[model samples]
Target: MPRPGARDPQAPVATADVSTAAESMPRGQRSAARPIPALTLVSHPTAARIGERLLLQGLLAGREVALSRNAPDFTRPGEPLGLPLGDPFLSRKPVLFVPVGEGVRVVPGDEGRCTCAGEPLHGGREFGPEELARGVPLEFSGRTVLLLHLAPPPEAHAPASLGMVGQSAALHGLRRHIERVADVDVPVLIRGETGAGKELVAQALHARSRRGGPFISVNLGAIPKELAAAELFGSVRGAFTGAQRDREGFFRAAQGGTLFLDEVGEASPEVQVMLLRVLETGEMYPVGASRPVATDVRLVAATDADLEAQIADGRFRAPLLHRLAGYELRIPPLRERREDIGPLFLHFARQELEALGEAHLLTPSDPYAPPWVPAALAVRLLLYPWPGNIRQLRNVAKQLVIGSRGQSFLELDARLAQELRLPQTAPHRTPPPGAPTPAPAPEPEAAARRKSTEVGEEELLAALRAHDWDVKKAAHHLGIARSSIYDLIERSPSIRLAGDLSVEELTLCFHACGGNLDEMVRRLEVSKRALNRRVKELGLVPKDA
Candidate 1:
């Protein structure tokens, strides 16, 4: 978003909430624009396309709404939206979508294959208006995924491709803004949080513009103060210490194209004057050049900082701000568009998996097993307050793909949990005086034990190494059951059990590591528990405990 990337002339882009895009409509149009219950396809058994909506306004006339395997009344998206899901694994019985007073009740069929929020749906579950507003994910037969959310009625014109993904209304609004101003030949001031994908919006503007020049992007905050002027404008040879020849700076490089300046608020006072001159007169003076050079480049600047505060502090020039903000595009934070999380995740996962020739990971195994990306994880992704925005979500997608390599299913390790900032300890709150006594809480867990869910592959390996391959000690230290730890080892393709090692190999490694079980664990990569037992059975002299 430059706040969700769209044009709204009525309000300042900085303060506009993209979620309330429909609120701006006239009284008559507002009723037509009011969001109604809808289901958008996220994934299909055989197709990767998404974002086709199944509006319920026309389909549900205050009665029951049905989503069966053979439902043929609805419109199709990328896949046969009016499917049989084309998934042979799906049950013949249909899942009912009954509209209650304000919320919709999802009644799972007898097969019990549906899941949401990381739990299997065995019975009817009602999604409140609030939950549906944020969007609820429903998985069928471990293959098809549909997001149940509130969406406005269909528009006469579909959104043009601006390289943005998702079916959220905010995204639609953003497209509207970009389409309106892309070819107006005006400097665009993009305001958004860091990692909110401001540069993507800038690119979209350029892509949609009439200019045929290349897009040049640079981070104003990253450029050194001394080099800022020379970098933006050209420098003649012998003008500076590093200048051996005439330099074509960003302005000239992007001639007739768009130049995106990220973190524009960080521009120094000196550079500010230069920018002001360029905007005022369409001419710039290079650091060591004698004459002014005219540039036809479109200017797009982005910043997450409060420029008004900087203006009050006398750091940034107000005149420069006026020039850069010919048009404003505000990008909404990731938290505002939770419905897009699932589709965005799949988009990223597919890219990474396909690149590594592990595209098969995109599909679940046999019907009984879970999907590669767990529903709980998807819900967590939606719930997480991503301060880093879309950039953070992309990182998580890459982590899941690389971390789950060679495994049948992805595991939630400690590192990922910490990164997502998922709650670890239950913080005790002081009860008010004279309040009724609360029920006793469960026993406190071990002080420093590492549970299976809390330990990542590397962390688990390190714990084993620290405990010298003693499974019991490691299990105790990890606060996990020994059997569960063994299961973790069994699932790890990189780790080996003592049984897999030959007696000769064990004896040779025993001498190689000088019978140091810890060292042996590192070299053999076998379970310390099994290795220790083998050492005992071999009757080797017990050196250290």
Candidate 2:
């Protein structure tokens, strides 16, 4: 019997025959079932040592048997035995043993057609007798049995490239947003802090897009001012000095695919105007060319800088910003989504360690344990401004994994702390105790107490409102854990539940923000995750009422 998961040999052969076979066989014979060839079990030294067993059934009674070192030559029996010989015969199966030889072969008939296919007595193929005598070992299985090799099934190939790794809510939301926009031909503007993996997101969008052309990525800030326009829109020969030949720019190169413009806020006004015209009409005029060339391309622009702020400051064009930002996605900085740092650190460390071929030296525990960044490091990471975001974190992890000879948390933390110029400890300043202590008056004492209470109440109310009166959002917005937020809400008297909000107020805020969560989050200065959780917890249905 064939092994489990093994493909049936007849299936492929039958498919090929059905597709390619000609009409030569008689109709009755073609439809009639042929007797399956007898299966002879062959054992090798390895198989025998492992005690592998094979069971066979359905045999004709009184069939004559002959055994040989190579192929078995069978002859018809002169007399039938009591062991029945009909098609429906049932009886104890007889066990027959043939002499052990270099290999086993079964000859089914006198016509030289062997069950072994005349190929070999074992797993290997047999050549002519002369070649077999020359000690080629008969190209058979010999004393060692081996399994047959089979082809793999066809499948749609997934890209083998690496992508940003992290399943934190922030990253999941970003992935969902990318999926929603990838197939559309609309322009996408990605805004994030530097090192926040904006380029990776752009690449993912390109990979998911239907367009099959080249994905051209251009860093607008990297291009020289004189060559910016020509580089983006292409240039004709003799367009400028030393112009040897006509060159197709990124826009033309990326036809039908995606054109990624990184640091787009850095584009000069002249380039912006040119880009605006190209976006307005799907045509571009090459430098020194009289006519405009029409080209199809999807635009994906990324900027660490705030383009809206740039426009307000007149550093960027407002109209161009609108054209570029057809669909805007903002990637949160690492500091904002500190929950993802642990996974990202491990991902980069493993990648770098593998690249250096020192993967064995670095274990999975290396990134999570002390001497590098301990569990306490999460708090520090949360506090960090992370001006460089995920990119900086990846670089730091790579550096630590490469530089640290001993995978200890303390050593790693010391190195990181020193590099980041963290304070060793809080500084202490002693004041003169002899100096007269300022005594608070009754009115001033009362005012100070009232101010303290007001600050606490304001923060509590702000968190409560941001979370839609759900305790969770209030906690996240305050940067404390969920339990802390719940405790504060339980203690606070001024805060109201989301369900208690007047229908009119809910409708007003929802309409004012156009049902945009990010806008709402920003308006409330609350964490998006917390706000969403609060929305669900509070059972507040969004007002289209």
Candidate 3:
């Protein structure tokens, strides 16, 4: 005999007796169990229609089963599930799945009571048509219940950190300068050649200032002239024809924080006057606004141009220069700090690999090794005169990593030179027949012939070149004053010799030889005073030279 609740094999509805008087009962009223077929999980409207076809086929064929309305049991309850429902041509709905079987029981509730005879069955409640169409899931008892899911929300991302990845003396000096001046709120003037990472230094200052507010930056060179004043100082809603709403200036935006003005030398004279006022009074007036607003911003300015020269030329304000340069920090260019090249190269290469999503290729077990660039390459890098400084170095490294195919040192050098537009071999040249070759020019002979005039000149030029033209070092090497070395370079015969060499050339030689006055003195083979006096006499403009 079959069990009391067991399903019958042949009967559409299982019953204890089939001989009851069915003719006396209404057609629709029958003591029979409604057969339920297996549930079909679907994720698309078309798929759900196919399921309906299967369901209707089973129903019309008098198969002893109907479509199941209960939710399907998922293996991983918390996993996301998408379900589709509704008429094929009229409506469509999407439903999300959340696991809820651990602690909660699926039972008939007042809101979802079934009208079927016998036992009441309730597994899931119906959501709104629109909610069901969107597949947003809900969580219950550590399970994700199918609710509705809309389009995925945008992913949040973090800002990239500043790329200061070297620990060379130059970088250390810059870091120390930032730390020392960060707390004081005094205006800082950062000086460096273009692309020498002056802006990075400014960012470091702002990062360490701990000013408790936003760090706002404005590139004075980029702002348009007509909008410059209004942009920096803001404007009232009706200040101009197109002014639709009141705006806050950079000063107000950077309140209680740091405001970095890049290319400060580019500010218009009128803007300079206003800047001086703000620096002195800590107050600013927006365009068309009568009242002044107080600001507690720390000013940090940067420039590649010599503001003093600008002042002399009547292009930059002298008073403004004095006010802005409360504490000046000069960032040495890449050619001046070749010791930082290897480390900076690795840093940039790693960053490039990561950016390309090929970080795994840079691992320790990888076939390619970062080529050990020879001193020849280093010297070349030093001599190329990186007008773009660290930023350019980073770009070159990135290009090499992206384009290089092998680990051979020569290959790396070739690729680097190609990428940087550098020559693979030093250019070969034949000295002109009558031209005095630099090599045959005897330092001692020149010194002896013009002792009174040449001794000081030779010594100064040698010491200056040896120390990479660093005034203090050259002076110390020759036991003289820094000011004295400057004086001798101004009046030296060697000054004329160096006149042909640009400031960049002298600086490159200085850095390439490790800023050693003794090495430079020996190489040039000139007497100390001769070298010293010559540098002083020449008065070489170190900034431009």
What TM-score against the true fold does each predicted structure earn?
0.67, 0.49, 0.49
Clashes of each: 17, 9, 54
Give one digit per residue, the lDDT tens place, for model 2 in 1-545: 11234233223111001110112235575333221112211112111111111111111122333322232321111212212111111112321322112222222222221212113232213222222111111112122111111101111431222376543334545665676667766677887757778889889888898347788899999999889988988899998998889999888888878899999988988799988887777778988899998877878898866464456457889878777777777776664444345446656766876787755543333222222333234334333445567777777767776776454331355668654432122211112235574554322111111222233654665344423444443444454555555455545543333443344554565566666665555444344555555554545544332
Cα error, candidate 3, residue 330 (Å)? 0.7
As for lDDT, the candidate ahead, 1 or 3, is: 1
User: Evaluated with TM-score, which candidate comes out highest?
Assistant: 1
Candidate 1 residue-wise lDDT, 67-170, digit = tens: 66666343533334343444566777778887776777778885468877546665677777777876777877766677888875666676775788776777
| Each model's lDDT | 0.71, 0.50, 0.50
Q: How close is candidate 3 to the true structure, as a TM-score?
A: 0.49
Off by over 4 Å in 1: 1-28, 41-53, 58-60, 69-81, 85-96, 100-102, 105-128, 137-146, 238-244, 363-369, 421-545
Tens digit of per-residue lDDT, candidate 3, span 354-468: 7877555433242223213332343344345454677877887666666653442323456566544432222222233365656632212111212223336545654444344
TM-score of 2: 0.49
Highest-lDDT candidate? 1
Deviation from truth (RMSD, Å), model 2: 27.2
